[model samples]
Target chain A: METKGYLDMDLLRFTTAGSVDDGKSTLIGRLMYDTKSIFEDQLEAIERSSEKRGDETVNLALLTDGLKAEREQGITIDVAYRYFATPKRKFIIADTPGHIQYTRNMVTGASTANLAIILIDARNGIIEQTSRHTFIASMLGIKHIVVCVNKMDLVDFSEEVFSAIKKKYQEFSSTLNLADIQYIPISALKGDNVVDASKNMDWYTGKTLLQTLESVQIISDYNFEDARFPVQRVIRPQSAQYPDFRGFAGRVEGGVFRPGDSITVLPSGLTTKISKIYNADVELQEAYSPMSVCITLENNIDISRGDMLVKSDNLPNVEQEVELMVCWMNDKKMNPTGKYLLRHTTNEAKCVVKNIAYKMNINTLEKIVDNFEVEKNDIVKITLKSAKPLFFDSYKRNRGTGSVILVDEFSNETVGAGMIV
Target chain B: MSYNLNHLEQLEAEAIFIFREAVEQFENPVILFSGGKDSITLVHLAYKAFFPAKIPFPLLHIDTGHNFPETLIFRDELAKRYGVKLDVGYVQDSINRGTAVEEKGLNPSRNTLQSITLLEKLEEGKYDAAFGGGRRDEEKARAKERFFSHRDEFGQWDPKNQRPELWNLFNGKKAPGESFRVFPISNWTEMDVWQYIKKENIALPSIYFAHDRNIVNRGGVLLAESPYNTLLPGEKYEQMHIRYRTLGCMTITGAIFSDADNLDKVIEEVAAARSTERGNRADDKRSEAAMEDRKKQGYF
Candidate 1:
């Protein structure tokens, strides 16, 4: 509640993926309540709903089940975004359902997250759901992951059980590519090692979940090596006050750019020098990844939306045929023969699936090369050949420019998302 | 090597990016200004979004005829100051045309009718994108909304089929006769809005600050004494110094008893408040899925 102390605080956007019985909602409720973020009226509403439903105790899960269908079915059908703030940082939790059927929802939540919190029941160790969520997180290039071994109270806070789960998890996760993984033992229901350090687990000497969330090293998560600026709009204020001001309006996708930096316009290959960078009225000396600024170039090259600007020395791969791992989101089947609208950053083009490399067997991490039928929640490595060449980098190199989405041309629904290989 | 932005700055940048995206993506875009703090903050963000040039779009206000006089004054002055056209689609017009009927009850506020009028005007103007000031943290159903939410030809929002909004890539592509309701500040909370308002020193309507008004408490929800509301058998209006946490139709937007007369005090009070900002809104108390139902019918 103290604004003066930490008004200028960074934000951390993380996603929580857990099974039905993992107490994921309870864990979130505990965090919000302990942090004094659960408002009184909201708590009362939850209490009333719990009482009406004849729940033995206050049902914290009621707080997250937003839609009528979700509350009726007692499941999270969509991603629910919740916000909380500590004096140190502001947190945005993209709470997603963890059932196998809700993989699309989890993918939606994981896309924007800097970190992913995979909740594993202490008794169950590492299960299929765990690997699915973890694989999705790693596939999405989430740099940090926190594995909360929930329900430590049921295990009597035994360190051996925690060690076994950790061992099994580390063994299974060794096969996958994970950047950072921290295991914590906690009981979301009994409030152990969630907000404060666990008193029950004296042997475990790790920071509480809140501490980890607040102090996680996320500054290096951004791709600053390659400078990619996808021009979303061109600000041409042919006005009397400072006429002939043509600024390329865009959010810096990656790297740091300064005035006088020589940049190349994609597709056209025209070269220009940055004249100025403006964030609203104040002129910025330099702009980096994710900052929405208007940049002016010295050369008046014909540029519009869908055109990209990058450092001339460092260029991106401009290719018409691109291979990527596509995650099918909609119920409609992905048609390899039909053309779909492929959108990458500000660029939109028509593309058709050239070939399906293989399908990922989530449980075994095997490749199913024979099966090419892509259905809902299916992640397949496919090659798409667009009508126009796309300027992009690998998904690992730059998430902002490398990622793309496929939309159904007729239905206008975003059916698939992909990471450029 | 250090490139870090505070939460406010990050939220501002995100909002500005969204604004530019909507402007560039849609052929015709408009900002749905409700004269509330959220919409006012949205307008301020729009100004920062297209800095040297004026906002590329006009502002649309669905006037419910039951407005606070101060709100209309503030709304007109803001539009004039920004040098943008202010288009008002009156609910009374819808009523006159028999397209919308007024609710017959003790509290027959025109809050719900604004949606119909809004859809009519948007159809009339052929606007493809309507930017709203709705925040996810405000209501339960809104927590699941995407940045660029699509509406069908009937202006119906099918929550089950929302696009998967991943990363910073927002797909604003839609067919003809369909419009998108885009919320730039989807990640912002009530506290964040107030803090940004204070940090930016943005101007707000006088009703946001504490002032004496004739208010009637109906079922523990304080409703200002306006022509739209009729006094019950035993209910009577009493003078009270109050400030509003949100602005809506004066008949339904409940006022809280407070003395927070300035932005600093308001933010301080908000920080210490126990109840949620929307706890006082009587409209939401209609049903558990009130917001979801209204949103499905294209309520901004």
Candidate 2:
């Protein structure tokens, strides 16, 4: 956990996963309440609801679980998002339910997260749930992991207990290709080491959760080395003021785009020079990741939505066949011969599942290829062939351009999300 | 020429991109103009989206018949300046046709009835899509809303059955007679909108700025007095310096006591405010899922 300094306006998305009673919601609530992110009226409403339910203390878990049945059962059953901002950075917390039934929801939330927080109970440290979360985090390409040994107060804040659990998890994590892993001892029930440093834990030396969150470096997380721009829409302001104005409107997914840079529009193979960049009339010298801009070419070459603008020498692979790690979201099973909508970048094309290569065992990281069936919530390795060739990199290269989602045409619902392997 | 985009400018660019995409994707899309600051900002974004070209779509105003006269003035002036067509769907017409019944007695408002008229107008005009200025930061339910919201033939939105929007790829596929509701500024917060408005120097309705207005303090809320609001016996009206956090029917929209009279000051105030802006809208006070329930019924 880095707390060396502070910068302004940084953004980091992280996911929280735990089995049944790890106090994930309490940790999140404490973070929000201590940081003043919780409003007065919302607190009052929660207080009233808690009193009505005859609970002595306000149920902090109620803050995240908005569904009625979950509230009645006192358990989370789906992925609920909660947003809070410190002056330094904005945080989007995907509170994923711990139940095995909602594995799809957990995958959906953790897929886009930059970091994954795996909570372990002091009483039951490094159990099956811990392995399940750790495997999912690694599989989803979450590079950073923070293993918080929660409920330390129940174990009398024992240093031996924390060290034992930490050693075991470290051994398992070594097999994974995670970039950064941090261990912390905290009691979420008593608000220890969440927002503020715990007074009792003098044996541990690390920044608190809030401090770690605010100072964690994320600017380097995006792929800024490859220049890939997917054309979203064509901007033609054919008014008398700028009648001949023609620009390719889209967002820069990776790398930097500048004027005078020679670019080529993919799928059409039309080459052109960057004439100008406009974010609304004001010309920009350069634009980078996540910044939307309209680029004008020196030539009036044909370019439309779903087209890619990339450097000719460093272009993505244009392949009709793609292999991916697919997370099935819908209840229906994946049909090998069924046609589905494959959306990657801004391009949408029809695709068919060529084969189910293997299925992942959630608890144990084993590949099951013999009797493969992609049931709901099953994260499987599959091969797909699109009607048209898609220009894309592996999901590891650029999350924005490499990831894809499968939509069922019959129901018009996104049935599965995939990362190109 | 290349440009360096500031934070708000970057957000504006994203919004403009989404707006133009909606224009190309939908057959006949209309902008839902409420004359509020959010919608006012949307108008400016749409204008910039086409730059020298006229905005490619018309503006749709679901007039509740209880709106402030100032809002209507602002709406008309905006349409006239941009040379864009404005379509006003009146709730009174829905009531006249007995399609929507109005609530009576004091606190009489047409907020809920506006949905019926809006749906009828969309059906009549055969609008394939309607663009809104809604943001996720407004409420809990809104936080779950997709950028491209799909509506059934009955103009109802199903939150559970949303199309997964991934990496700027918006799927606008819908069944026949079904229309989509596109929100270009779905990711922006209230403070972000105000900051963008200040940075862009976008003109807005006067009610957004602080001014002397006759208001009644009822149930600890500063409710602006209007013809539609029938005051109760003990409620006393007084003049106060206040500004509206949002604009809707004057009967349902509440005012806040503030000294922030200009765009910069409003932005600063919004940044420092502890409560959500939609907290001022009395209609949401009805229940926890007020916005979600209304949206499920196609109330934009």
Candidate 3:
């Protein structure tokens, strides 16, 4: 493998979501093994574990079931991050658990993923888990989805079986707002069409699973129209050398910014001009989304943490009362008009539940209106009134500026993850 | 506009964002330094996170009292170069104070005993957050760790009861007595760390490069000779030109025989290497659940 120009390679982060026996772990194992990402020691360790468990063949699932309880029960309880790199792009797989009880873990994993791989067992076709995971993936603002029809070997690698599963999945996914969807048939255990092309199913001509992952166009995933920078800290060097240095430190959440751009600080409604944008001691000509840089405004203003810097005219909605679709994460059910802390970007406020709009029946994508009792792993749409106004857009507009996590006051556990409507 | 960041830039950007979040969330924070490459990379990112301004947090080293001599000098120089405070918590001090009992064995390692000293120092300093150089790819137990990992009042990690972290928005809220062990580079792998070190031209300890050291082979793992470890019968230190893959208490860390003395050669060696970096760690070799057990007891 050539190491030259390896520094110029980009990164792609995706997640895998499915039921317990959908061969998610085995698929990941095949990908890593084919790409030579699994080290010899790790394979040896898992081989030893497989033998100790009295398995006939090496259990690839043991690679991700890292926790003691998980290993004992032979199930993945939490999100296990796996890494691999092709010659073109590096990949980060947020392998989330797929049990219904673990839906919250799936939501957590999909929040930062650019794409989501939803596995389908060919024998079972599109099950409830297939739709439930798809709903969560689309709800979390993931634009790309790859439906991997796994276990083709179990189905005798029939072309009719693959097409039927794809058609039904497409009909079910029509309700979601996913941008791009692709289908591939493969058997994770038999290494069919995972890394290399499969000869077993020559009738279906398509890119392999690894090819789809490596060739996915993810450059247009981030929102680049509205410039939003929420200040996390104010860097001020008090020393004698360049004593008057004051810059706003933040990661650009959306759009682009350059020196002399007219910027407005949210909640304060103060306006200033960008004098310089410093990316850690080195000044840059332009800064875009996801780059952590310090911005120096022309006028010294009272801009502090929780203050957002955006384009003067292209402003986000500043509202005290907001509607959100939240995935309940904790066992402690949400109370009526419950007071919880809401964190958005760099700012946070004490927010009360104004109203519960509806709860989603994840399996059928139906709205349950009458019963408002929310439990863990339930997706509910609710309205919130915060202590202060939050500058934001709809979740579909920009994921970075449009997401919030609700923290329980007494327990301090992240109880709900929300996206603005 | 491309709106694209290379893998290195992307990792750097994510780490810097996390660093600033800790600065804004916690009242008092410190970087848990070990004079290793990971901590060294952490320090470099923190410096860039708050450029033009001095690093806001101090460096806290839980000294095992058995360290590479080169690491000691490098740690002091790094502290001075960054103009940050260096706070050392000595395991020997904990042992002398009777708070921690040292192990009595043929090959006694201070690795597990450092937890007692670490918790004591965190309590003594009343630090609300301790930034560590923990990467998920390093160990299996760490693979599912949260970026802002919470510790109880006793500084014990409850792996099963961790809060769900979503997106870049980290929930750092905690009770009054509880503290957090935050890992900014939890997503980076071992290869990413080495590549970043080379890309940024970051300085590391001399032990990381190829050097001649007197080491003894124990169960196929070569351990460098130090006063902290005693040799078994028929065991003698042999001169070998080897380099350390990881740095810890000199008694536990193992070395590999290689001639990769420079950055390019080191990256090349790491690329074609077959074993995990922590495969040589005696502490992890104790059991499959060793890292998890140690993490539960407040080990970094």
Candidate 4:
């Protein structure tokens, strides 16, 4: 294997959603095998286990269904993360189950992904689970969607089948906010059009799945127009050496920040100039989204965790009352008037659900105005009254600053995930 | 155009962010130091996270009383070099107090006893958060572990009931008497760890490099002959060149035959290696779900 681009390779995190028998694990296993990511020992272990279980073919699903219960039950209970890398890029696959009851797992997996791969069985074109997965991906602000129409071998590698499924999916997803969508007809079981172009289906002219993933333009996926930095910690070295060093440390959520840029600290509304941006000891002229750094300001303002810094010219909405589309994740039903802990970008506030506007029919993309009770797996738009004002934007405008998690105050469990409207 | 971090730098920043979060959230936190490459890399990251100022938390080493002498020396030297407090939880103490019983067999290892000592130390010290060097790619059971893994009052991990970790927002909340096991490098792989160590020039134990050592082959694994390891009948020691891929109690940790003595060679060897790092570990060879069973019992 070539090692020239090993040092400069970028990282891409993608999520996979598929029900049982969709060959999700097989596709992943094929990718690993083609990329030489699977070790000999792991392959041998899986082979031995597969033989013991009386599987005629080596069950690649056993490689991912790692837990005892999961292997015994033949289902993925939780999201299992798998890593593989080619010379071009390093990939992290958040393998999530596609069952309706595991919607929260999909959400968790897709939350940090750059792309979403929705697997569709060619035999069953555009099922309910396909729409459900696509809707959740769109809700999570994933821009790229790779619709893998798998099991093409069973469909005789027919172009009509692939095109039909693609057209149906495109029609349904035309209303979604997906930016880049691509279709690939693959046989995860037969190694066709996955890592290499298929010899069977010469009608497909586009790149293979691996080629598309390796060459996708993900650098511009982040929002670089509005600068937002939520301070996670205040670095103050109170020691004898350089006692006056006080820096606000945080990961840049959006846009570009540079030295001498006039910024406004939210909530306090204090304006200051950034003197230096340090990415771990080395001072750089500029920093952008997803890069964690500490910035030293011209003034020693009263700044701590939960306070956001934005460009003076560009500001976010500061308000105490906000509307959000929330996905209830806990088993307990959401109480409309109950208090919860609302955490957004390092800031935590006590909030209460003022009213449930409507619940979303995820499959049909319809709003049920009559149903007000928000149960598990229900996506509802509700109004929240927070104890303190929050700095935010719409989830569409900025995913980093516009997302929040609701923690049940009594149990301290995260019960709901919300995207600010 | 904006500046973007490469893979290693991105991983470093993420680990640092996690460390800062743990310090900000938990009142009492400690880093679990086993003097392995992963833990050594964690210490280096922690030191960088709060640079110029000492690490906010102390370093806790659950000594199994069967560790490589080089590992102990390196651990103490690292703690002193970083100017951080070091706390030792001895497995021998647990055994003497009758809190832990030793396994009666030819290959009895104190590896499992360290769990009891670690939990007892945590309860005694009232540590609310413990930093472990666990990576998701290490074992199957560890793949489902959260960055902020919650432990019940009895110090058990319920894999099915873990909190949904979304984006970088880790839910570290737990009930009273409960604590969290924070894995800052949970996303890093074994190859990534070695690359980071090579880039950062992090010091490790000499046992990691290939050297001539007396070993006995047991169950197709090379076990370093030590006073702790009792050789079975028909087993004889042989001198061979070997290096440890992982570090644990001397009895359970196995060394693989290799000649990758330096960082560059080690990286190349790792890239071309055919087995997972834990393939040679006897403890994991106990059963298919050995890691899971141990983790359910609160074994780090």
Per-model lDDT: 0.92, 0.82, 0.92, 0.90
User: In model 2, which residue pairs have backbone atoms overlapping below 3 Å?
Assistant: A283-B2, A283-B3, A284-B2, A284-B3, A285-B2, A285-B3
Expressed as tens digits, the lDDT of each residue in B129-191 for candidate 1 is 999999999989999999999999988899988888988888887888888999999999999
In candidate 1, how many Å is residue A204 off?
A: 1.3
- Clash pairs (backbone) in predicted model 3: none
Docking class of 2: acceptable
> What's the TM-score of chain A alone for every prediction?
0.99, 0.96, 0.99, 0.98
Which ranges in model 4 have alpha carbons more than 4 Å from their true place? none
> What DockQ was computed for model 3?
0.81
lDDT tens digits, residue span B126-178, model 3: 99999999998888899989899999999999999999989889999999989
Global local distance difference test of model 4:
0.90
Q: Can you tell me which runs of candidate 1 are displaced by over 4 Å?
A: none
Chain B global fold similarity (TM-score) for predicted model 3 against the true chain B: 0.99
Question: lDDT by residue for model 4 over A281-361, one digit each (tens)?
Answer: 778888887887889999989998999999999999999999999999999999989899999988999999998999998
The single-chain TM-score for chain B of candidate 1 is 0.98
Residue A73 alpha-carbon offset, candidate 2, angstroms? 3.8
At residue A289, what lDDT does model 2 achieve? 77
Which tens-of-lDDT digit does each residue in A1-421 have in candidate 1? 6877556789999999996699998999889988999899899999999999899999988888899998888888889999999988999999999999888889889988999999999988888899999999989989999999999999899999999999998998987788799999998888899998888999999989999999998888988878999998888878899599889889998988999999999999999999999998999998987899999999889999999999999999999999999899988899977799999989999999999989998767889988889999999999999999999999988899989999898988899999999
